[model samples]
Target: MRLYKIMIVDDEAEVRQAIARKIDWRAVGFEIVADAENGRDALEKAETLELDVVLTDIKMPFMDGLELGAELARRKPNLKLIVFSGFDEFEYAKEAIKLNVVEYVLKPVNAAELTAILDRVRGTLDAEIEQRRNIRQLTQAYQESLPLLREKFLLDLLRGPMDPQVLEAQAERFGLAVREGAYKVAAVCDIVHGGEGRPALSDELVPVSVRQMLSDALWDRCGSEIVLGVPSILVATAWERDPVESLMRLLGEVCTECKRILGVTLAVGIGRPCQSLAELCRSCAEARTALEYRAVVGLGKPIYIQDMERLDRTAPEWDGHREQQLLSVIKFGTREQIAAMVDKLLSDGEGEWSDQSRVLGILGTLLSILRRCRLGEEAMLGPRGSWIKLLAEDAPMEALRDWLLSVCLNMSGCMDQRRVSTAKRLVEEAERYIREHYPDSGLSVDRLCEHLHISQSYFSTIFKQETGRSYVQYLTDVRMEHAVELLRATDDKTYMVAEKVGYDEPNYFSYVFKKRFGVSP
Candidate 1:
């Protein structure tokens, strides 16, 4: 029940008071917010107060009520006008009708007639509000049906190399303002799949819940976080630049709150910031790529493109053989094998990407792995992979690789979590395999599982349970201990030292050692 705010206008102060006192305003869903001496004062007050109705007398000084009514009707057509004049001239009545208010009132105004008219005004206001509300809901529904439009627009903006004028016009069509600033696209798709009790394939409400939180949290700084996800998953998109930290922080807060209240875990991928829509598209692709690593980092966390970029920078130069082996894992590997393979591929490259061209080449090799998997081609043909156009190009060595890896992982169904009961025997077998093969430079959790003919994800989980450390960490501990013993007992070149410890790249081997021992070999 909304109160229709109103104002009373009369030249004489007594008449205005008499009318105001005669009515029980609250009873009729109206409130007399102000009383003006004449139409001029009433107009000023109406503008300031944004009143809903104006009650005026035709006779007044410094602007009469009829003149005031005409002016107000032009400016605020929605405002209801009730005029009571002493003169009963037909010309005045005709002019009053043109003003388009409630109705012209005759003086001395009757209390009941004015009261009934005020009631009518309240009803009109109520009806108008309801109509507007209905229109908004309908608009939202229509928008929902055409999500592909927004997605395509966003996809084009993110895919890159579009003419600026064209992209700007497309953005305008979607009600998006492409402001000039370094905008980063964050892909929030990496949702953590929990164990048995984790809600089975989230309800559609999951997407709705996230969008609501985003609206409440981001307000005007962002557009609606359109759900760019499949039925089982919730992938969302957002682009931001100014106050990047605030955006991230707000997202993090929403993630935490959603997890607590809605039992949802979200992984956010922050892209490298870039100016212009094309670059932003590349950044978006990079974000989606970073999102693929969220599984490696576990759930309930935000992954930044900076973190992935750092990994790309520090990772050892690409290994073709290792990459081929990774492709094999993707082909035959279980969920865990694919997960561990991705981890090993990245981990082995720690501290290796030094040259830009080399990084570009390595990134190409990574994308090639996806192409071999055909996951890239599949997604490229789908609605989501418009940005996959760059299979291999100079590409600034940035997003194409990340996009490929993300798409491959998505296709591998790496999020395809297979819950296995932790078993003591499984852990013991993993430990035995590691102790025997920790010295093999090519040995990995994936390989260890393959040798044991166990599910990689299952083996890794149980092994973590028994050994209290990841297989990689446990293996590193063994190698580092041996390296320390060798450093103490005999003199060997650092590269030789690294090789004996099962690290093919001596620099990477050193990184692991320094991380463990806090000193370079």
Candidate 2:
């Protein structure tokens, strides 16, 4: 049984003394810590003692019980208040209710009634203390899970797009401070036994060791979050001009040290530099593409996507790069994007036909894509090799252009149907989660994405397209609806209502309410 510190306040000293004498402070799990003649005096005394309860009279000179209770509520929101008075006035009772007074009793004090009130206060205090303990335990658990949460954030950064503001907030929450500079992404792939066509056998510790080494190497040069995964360690770095080259040098050293120290060889794929963290997903994708070129650049080195682009630019004939670009457009690009890319590939800058070799390369790429999409090539090209006959005829440019556009657009339509169904499911889940968790003040887009096991960028895109509002806007609307209902159905105060509707700061909640409804809460 813990002792709760309490104070007694009344304008008359005799009444205060009588009230103190009527109760067994210790027996009721309380201590009469202080006594005062008026609300002002009690408030002054309150500044010195950490009190759990205040028993004060309703009509006190200098300041009344209502004023003192309001001030105390602001200073110590959890403090319990009880008002007792000689006169029974409905106005006083109304004010007491507004002040969140736990009990309003009439004087002269009755030992039995006062003791019962104190017992109830004791029970309330006990519950509050237990709640505090639980929150402390939760806080400790959160600290313990910080590392895993931070890893998830890094993975999110690499896997999908995050708005700049949301990205900064999430980074700050995870203790990953965002610096003011450009960022670049790198994929440290081909671990000891985690490369393509290789089995991941008893090499889980290799990535952990590589992450530590990478951290140690980049700790002074730049800030890096190295995410350890099978087959690769994704590194996002804040670096400056000559970013790719600088990263290549740093990664080369990490690779050398890794091999020399751990008896393992690895390759690094570096992406192009991005101006902001939001663009990291693109950089990450490019980095993964760079990893595929390890066979050409040889393993145990840092391969850059820019270097591959330079090679593609210098190639005289149709190459793998062109084939990849066309296939990507058909599979993932929008209809407009697919059309523009095909037109660019077929036109020789002056709207004339490009050379036959380039047209042939694009045709072959489309054939491969059709096969991959499980569509019959003959259905697309009319009896397999007949596309070659069409290519060799006069005025073949228009025919080839129209045929290629139709095929790419049709593929895009098929892809979009599947994508739209997935997007609808994602949006539905998001709405359900928001509705269920609207009262949670910590609910955020990052948390929602984590719950859905998807990227923030993808989720945000689909959610806005489907709902015609951002996640924050939608959450705000939901909170406001519940808040309006609570206000209409209950006598809860504005602060209480705010807490129930997922706002930790009552002032901010009121501001939002006013902004949305044009009236203060």
> TM-score of each candidate?
0.35, 0.35
lDDT of 2 by residue, 368-420 (tens): 66664455566656665565667767446677788778877877666556446
lDDT of 1 by residue, 398-452 (tens): 3543553564466555323311212555567677777777778878765776665
* Candidate 2 to truth, TM: 0.35
RMSD of each: 27.2, 23.0
Candidate with top lDDT is 2
Please identify model 1 stretches exceeding 4 Å from their true place. 1-148, 159-163, 178-180, 192-202, 222-227, 231-244, 311-521
Error of 2 at 341 (Å): 6.1
